[model samples]
Target: MIDIFGTLGPKCDNEIMLKEMFLRGMTGIRINLSHVKLFDCKDSIDRIKQAAKEAGTTPKILIDMQGPELRVGDFDGVVSLAKGYYQTLGDEWIPVDEKIIRAMEPGDEILLDDGKILAQVKEVKGTTAEIYVKRSGGLTGKKSIRIVGKEVPMPALTDEDIENLKFASEYGITGIMQPFVRNRDDLLAVRNQLQISGCPDLRIYAKVESMEGVENLENYINDCDEIIIARGDLGNAMPLWELPGVQKRIAKTCREHNKPFMVVTQMLSSMEKSAVPTRAEVSDIYNAVLDGATSVMVTGETAIGEYPHEVIKYLVNTANEADKKIKQNKTGE
Candidate 1:
C-alpha cells in the first residue's frame, strides 16, 4: 500500500491521539524539526513508540530537519507593511537588533516567509541597513526568512539537529527528511554527519523545495534514500502557477529511479478547521496516487487540525478507492 504520512503537532502529540491516527490509517509520523523544540520532539517520539506498541503496528517515524532556515526577528507582535512601502533593515527606519542583523551582509538576497518578498542589502550600518525590495509582497512579523544563493559554510549539523539525530538514533526512527538540499554535496554532508553520529542506517529523504534542488534532483536522489516534494516554500521559490509541472517532474523522476516520493503541503488544507475535505481536495489526492506518488503527507491538517483523525481516515479512504480503480483499469477485471 502507498504510505500515508501524517505530521505530528499540537493535535496529535499525545499518546491517545497518536493511537487514533495510527488506527485510522496513518502509516508514518513526520516530526517537523522546524516547529517544535527538541525536548518536545523527544517526548513526542516516546509517545509515538508507546502508542505504536499499543496499536500493534510499527509506524515509521520521519524526522524532518530544519536546514539553514532563516526567519525575521520577533516583531514584538505583528508588523504589517503595505505594498510598495519601503522598510529599512539597518539603522535608519526601524531599529535593528545587532545579533539578527549581523548575519546579513550587503549584496545578500533575503527572502521573507518562503520568498513572498525578495530583497537585497544595499548598505549596512550598526544593527541596521538599507534594503531594496526586488519583489514585494505582504511582510508580516516573525515570518520565515531565508537567504538566496547563500551556501551555509558551517557544518550541516546544527546543535539542535545533532540533538535530534541523537534522539532518533536511540529511537530507531525510520528516516530523516533533509530540507532544502541544494546538491549532492549537501546530501553527502548530512550523510557524513549521520554516520559520525552513529546513525548510518537512517534513511535520508531529500526535500526538493528550490530551483537548485529541482535542477540537481538526480544527484540528490542518488545520494539519499527518498524524495519529498515540499511545495510550501517551493511554491514561494517559483511561480505558483508552475507548481503543478514541478510536482509532476519530481514525482516522475522519483518513479523512474525507483525512489519513494511524497507530496506535502496543504493536501487537505480544509481539515485545518473542518472535518471534511473539499471535492477538489479529494480529486487532488486521487490524481497524486494515480501519478505513482509513493505517499501523501498531511501537514497542518493533522498537525493542528480540529479533526486530525478524521483527516487521516479521509486520506486513507480516498487513496484506497483510487488505488482500487486504478487496479481495475490495469487488469480489466
Candidate 2:
C-alpha cells in the first residue's frame, strides 16, 4: 500500500482534523521531536488514537528523534547582521552551545537554518570563533546547524530520546525514526536502547540524510525496519539539484532489498502557504512513487499550513492515482 503520512502540529492538532486526515488516507503521524518534547505531544498523541478510533483506522505513531545532529541553542530573538563582520557561533556573541564553539575550526563552513545562513570560520579562540557570514540570513533560535565535511561529536541518541524510548510502549508509539544514521552501528545503538526500554516492538526507520549515511547505506539497510529519504538534510548534504535523483536511487535500493521506504520533505511546500500545491510538488510525489517509494510524507504542509486538509487531499489524490497506475501495470489487462 502507498501509505500516506502527515506530521502532527498546530495546524492539524484537533481530533476532528486528525480524524479527517485519518479517514482521508493518512496512515501515520510523524512527531518531529527536534522542536517539541515527547511529553508535550502527549495530548496530540491521545488525540491521534482518539481520531484513529473515530476514523476506524489504525494509524501508526512515529516519533522522529533528534539523534546526534548539532543545532543552534536558543536565542533571545533574531540576530540580524550584514555580511563581512566576524562573529562566533555558540559564543557569548552567538548563544549556541560550547560543543559548537569547540568542534568547528578555521576554514570550516557552517550552514545554519538548513543552509539558509552560511558562516565561514576564520579562527577559534577561547570560547569564541571568529567568522564571516558568507550567506546572510537571520539566525533563528534552536535552528539546525550543519558543518560542511564534518559530523557533530554527540552521542547517537540524545538524553531526551532515551527517556522517550523508556515511555514509548506506554504511549503506544509503534515506530521510531532516527535521523542521521551513519551506519549499522548507529541503528544498533538505537535498537539496543529500544530493546532495553522494553520497546522491542517499535519498528525503526533509519533516516538517510547525509553523505556519510548514504555511503554506509548498505551496512544498515537490513537492520532498519524501514528507510526514510529525508531530503531536507539530504539536500543540505549535497547539491539541491541532485536531490531528486538521489531520492530515486535510495528508493530503488529499498525496493530491491524488500524494505519499505519513504520519500519525505517539501513534497507540497507551496501548500504550506497556498490552498493549492505547485505542479512541481505534484510531480515530485508522483516520481517518488514511480521510483518505488512505499510511502510519501509531508511535514510543514500539514503541520503549519493554512490549508491542512487541502494538502492531504492533494497528497491522497496523487498517491491514489499512482497506486492505481502501479496496479494496472502489474496486471495483464
Winning candidate number (lDDT)? 2
- In order, candidate lDDTs are 0.79, 0.86
User: Residue 249 error for model 2, in Å?
Assistant: 2.0
lDDT of 2 by residue, 126-178 (tens): 77778888888888777888878887667789888998787789999989999
Q: What residue pairs are clashing in model 1?
A: 70-145, 71-145, 90-128, 90-129, 91-128
Model 2 TM-score relative to the real fold = 0.95
Off by over 4 Å in 1: 73-86, 90-111, 115-127, 130-143, 147-155
Where is model 2 more than 4 Å wrong at Cα? none
Which prediction has the highest TM-score against the true structure? 2
Against the hidden reference, what TM-scores do the models get? 0.84, 0.95
Clashes of 1: 5
